[model samples]
Every structure is written in structure tokens, then in C-alpha cells.
Target: MTPRTFSVVIADDHPVIQLAVKSTLSAAPDLHVCATCSSGKELSAALATHRPDLIVTDFTMGRSEGNDDGLRLMQRLRQSSPATPVVVFTMLTNGGLLTRIRETGVAAIVGKNEDPAVLRQICLDALAGHRQRLSPAIAGLMASAGARADGVASPLSPREIEVVRMFAAGSTVTAIAAYLHRSLATVATQKRSAMRKLNITSNADLVAYARDHGLA
Candidate 1:
């Protein structure tokens, strides 16, 4: 019998990164690059059509048709393709962004600045249904995040913090609800509560807070 092959869909806005990732993955004997998409819209379409075993995508792909982008895109994949593992390949190093990404239950996260080999190995591991893996840097961040959680008595719940982080990263309320599986009212309530806790009266204030906290 022929060996089974794993298919991957790579999504990113940068053509150069897309090409590099494709070339790297194609070098693996059992891995195949089924499609490459430049936007979240294209990623969604590719998911529907190709149904690849795994997805390698940037954390932020500019908005495209279907309103899929960044956190929203990750949420859609979680809801629509629960079984397919997703690998976030991006340059974003924001702690808040990392927190929000973890909430979406991604399979692996490899920084774009790291060697391409790192991403390739993560891909191979994800294909095997192994537990989620975080690169050393990401693991360290999570460790510090935990310490922060323990030492700081933040007025906001982790969920609320995550929601604010996504909003700061450019997600709309509706998109947040869709991604987090919260009702519109629930999302709004959390947003309002987060703002109130931080004494933020406007979007500008919320954004500024996020930036100050390295969430943006």
C-alpha cells in the first residue's frame, strides 16, 4: 500500500514568506503543499475546498472578503474545522496576542523570525496529533504570563483580557463573538467591563491600554 500523505494550506499576506514556507514544507517527504492563500478569505475558501490536514498561517492576514482576519480567522477555523491542526507562523510577539491565540487552541506557534526548520518540525509534530507545542520563546512568555497572573490581581478576568487583546488587535465585536463563541451581548458586556475596570472611556483609551500592556 502507498504511504499516506499529509496536505497543508499555507496562508500569509507576504508573497515571499508564503514561498519560503511552501518550499520548506515541500521538502518533507510525506508532506504536500496543497494550496497557498494570501488572505483570510482565501484561507477559508481553501479550507472548504482542500480540507488539508493542517494549516500554516500568519497571525495577521489583512482583511479580505468574508471578514476573516487575525483572531477572527483563528476562531473560524476552530469552529468550522475542529479536527484540522493549525500552526500560527508570524512575527507578532505581543504577550496579549499570544494569550488570545492560546484561547483559540492553536496546534503550534512558531515565530517567523525563527529558522524555517523550526516551523517544519512543528508541522511534523502537529501532523502526528501530538500535544500542542510552543517554541522556547513562546514557552518563556507563557511562563512569565503565568507569574504575572499569579502575582498581579488584575481587575479583568483572563477571558476579558483575551477579548480586549483581540479587540486591540483589530477584531470587531461581532467578529469577537463569532470567534470566542460568546453572544454579542456577552462580548459587549466584557468589553464594557474591561474598559470600566481600566477607566477607559473610549476606543482610543482601550487601544492605549492594550499598547501600554504590550497586548497590541
Candidate 2:
């Protein structure tokens, strides 16, 4: 006898992550990618259309991020489909922010650092009533999240924060240096340091982070 098919809905802003997730889940005989959405608005619409058995989503989604994208969306999911299990598929490692994720009643949390195949196993486990599980790559993340449940604290120093805000707001590195009366080298270094602290190696990702943090 064939097992009951479980349709899955995936929501992420990145095409690569979406593709990876779709590919991973498609390998499972009983799992199906019923829909994929790139934004909260789209996810809401997909939920209405597909009414999927499981949802895999990200904390931030495109330009609408920092708009209470996490908590509010999770709240909506709970209200709209409380019985459907939700699995957070992300690469975010902010301990404090991850704590807030746990409060949202999601069924599971899987990091991008782990093989997407792990998500498949965790997805099956979540269906069996497990609340959450963490992979080895980010196992300590939740511990930190648990210890600092108060709230997310900024990792950037004040200078780094200033540098990041200016860069994100379209100020050129030279311009920011001139305006702040700092050497170009100093300003540039600060910008690079900030990016590193945020785990962003590319300018595009930095801009996305800025948008997600309301700095852009």
C-alpha cells in the first residue's frame, strides 16, 4: 500500500535555497513539493491554494524583511493552520533571534549548514510530534538561544554599525570616510569587519542583511 502523500510548501527569498530544498524533498517517495513562494505575501496565498501538510520557510524574505517578518508570520501560520507542522529552513545563527523562533511553536528548525537530507529526516520526526531538533553544525546555537532568551543583541560595534548604515544607505566608502572625518582605509576596514561579523561575505548579502535589520 502506498503511504499517504504529504505535500510540502517551501518559502525562501533565495532561488538557490529554494532549488536545494525542492531537490532534497523530492527525493523522498512520500514527500511532494506542492508549492514554492519567495515572500510572505506569496506564502500566504500558497497556503490558501495548496493547504500543504508541512511548511518549510525562512525568517527573512526579500525586501519585506525587518517588517516583523518572523514572529508575525509564525503567528499567522499558527492561527491559519495550527495543526500543520512548520519547519524553519535557514542559515541564521543568531542565538537570541533563534530563541524567538522557538517561541513561535514551529515543529522543527533545520540549518542550511546541514545537508538538506537532514531536513527530510527531521521533517518526518516533526510529523511524529517532536517540537524541534538541531543539527551538529548549529547544535550549540539553541543553547545560546536558550541562555539569552531576553532578546537579540547587536554583534557589531558602534563604529562598525555606523559604517554599515552608511554603506547600506548608498554612501560610497570614500564618501563615508569624508563625512565621518576618518581615513578611507579605516572606514573600509570597518565595513569589512562588520560584514565578517554578520557572516556576510558578499556585498549583496550585506545589503540583504541591512534590509532584514531595518538598516537599509
Candidate 3:
């Protein structure tokens, strides 16, 4: 069987990093960058209009005003399309952040400080169905002092689980509200409650918890 041609959407707040990703991915004949977004809101809007095979996103965007903007976008994406792979490339390499991102079920994690070629290759491998963890150093730290040792699965409610799954699939809050037929504020409240229950202080942390507990 022929492999499917993958369409990707790149989401990063940094112009330089966005350009770097675009330039690198452009070299691959079978991969196409269908959209580039600098904020979670922009990525959410693009995903509503286009269904890409994968999403390559930054963990944080200096340009975003909303809370945990990048992770929110990933959650929204996952909510809308669970099968679509999302790869996080960012500078937040601390064990705490890495643990949270893992929970979000991102296909791969690549540090910004790593070689651009290496990052690009990781993305490519993820598109081909491989689960690439963070760099050896990052992984070593996580294996040592991170949530893996905590052994506490997140204490998320079924509703929150539902919210997270939807978030991960790429459903916007508005979409989520509409789908659940609840008010926006109510949906937001429930999501927040879930985050609090899990002791997740940020979207990155939420992602890590979800990845760790297999909730995402």
C-alpha cells in the first residue's frame, strides 16, 4: 500500500522558529505545510477550516494572551480529531513541563535548542507512526525526578476527561460548548475544575499529566 501524503499545520509564536520549521519541512516532497499559525487562536481557527494530517506546535507563544494558549490549541485539536498527530517543539525542557506534555499524548517532543535537522526528522518519524520522546537529557531527567515517580494519575472528572479528549482533538471552546450544549462559562468552569483537580497549573502541565496518566 502507498503511504499517505501528510498535510501539516505549523503553530508557533516565534517568527524565526516558524520560518525554520517551514523551511525544513519544505524539503520533504511528501509533506506539505497547509497552514502556519502564531497563536493558539489562529491555529484553532485554521483547524476549523482545514483537517491536516498532523500539527506541529510550540508549547508557548509570547503573542498569545490567553492562558496556556499552545496547550489549549493542542487540546482543541485533539478533541476535534483524535487520530491527527500533534508534535510539540519548544524551549520548555524542564522535567515538570515535559511530564505534562507527555500527558497530552503528543506524538513527539523536540527541544528548540536541538538541531533543526533533528527536530525535522523527529516530526517526520512521528508522521510515520513512531512515538519519539524528548532528547536523552530531558528524558533522563523525567525518568529521574518527574511525575513518573509520583505515581498519581490525574484526578480528572469524566466531564473533564471528555473536555480534554475534545481539546486534544482540536475542538474550540465554542465548539465544545455547542457540542455539549452548555454555556461557555460552564464549559470553562468545568475545564478549570478538572485542571485544578489534577493539580495542573497550566496547559503545559495539563498536557504532561494527561500524557503521564494516558488520559490524552
Q: lDDT (CA) for every model shown?
A: 0.82, 0.75, 0.70
| Candidate 2 whole-model C-alpha lDDT, 0 to 1 | 0.75
RMSD each, Å: 4.2, 9.2, 8.1
Which candidate number would show the highest lDDT if scored against the true structure? 1
Cα lDDT of model 3 by residue, 26-124, tens digit: 788778889999887778777778888888888766322342354455566678778888888866534544566677678887777776777777778
lDDT of 1 by residue, 1-216 (tens): 998999999999999999999999998989999999998888888999999999999877665347466677888899999999999987755655576676678998888878778889999999999898787677666566562322333467766876787898888999888877789999999999999988999998898888776566
TM-score of each: 0.75, 0.66, 0.63
lDDT of 2 by residue, 79-180 (tens): 888999998887767554455666678887788888777998888787767756656555577565452434344677556765675677677898778766
The lDDT-based order of candidates, best leading, equals 1, 2, 3
Cα misplacement distance, residue 174 of candidate 1 (Å)? 11
- Candidate 3 Cα outliers beyond 4 Å, as residue runs: 1-4, 62-70, 147-216
Model 3 Cα shift for residue 172 (angstroms)? 24
Clashes of each: 0, 0, 27
TM-score of candidate 3 relative to the true fold: 0.63
For the record, the alpha-carbon RMSD of candidate 1 to the native fold, in angstroms, is 4.2
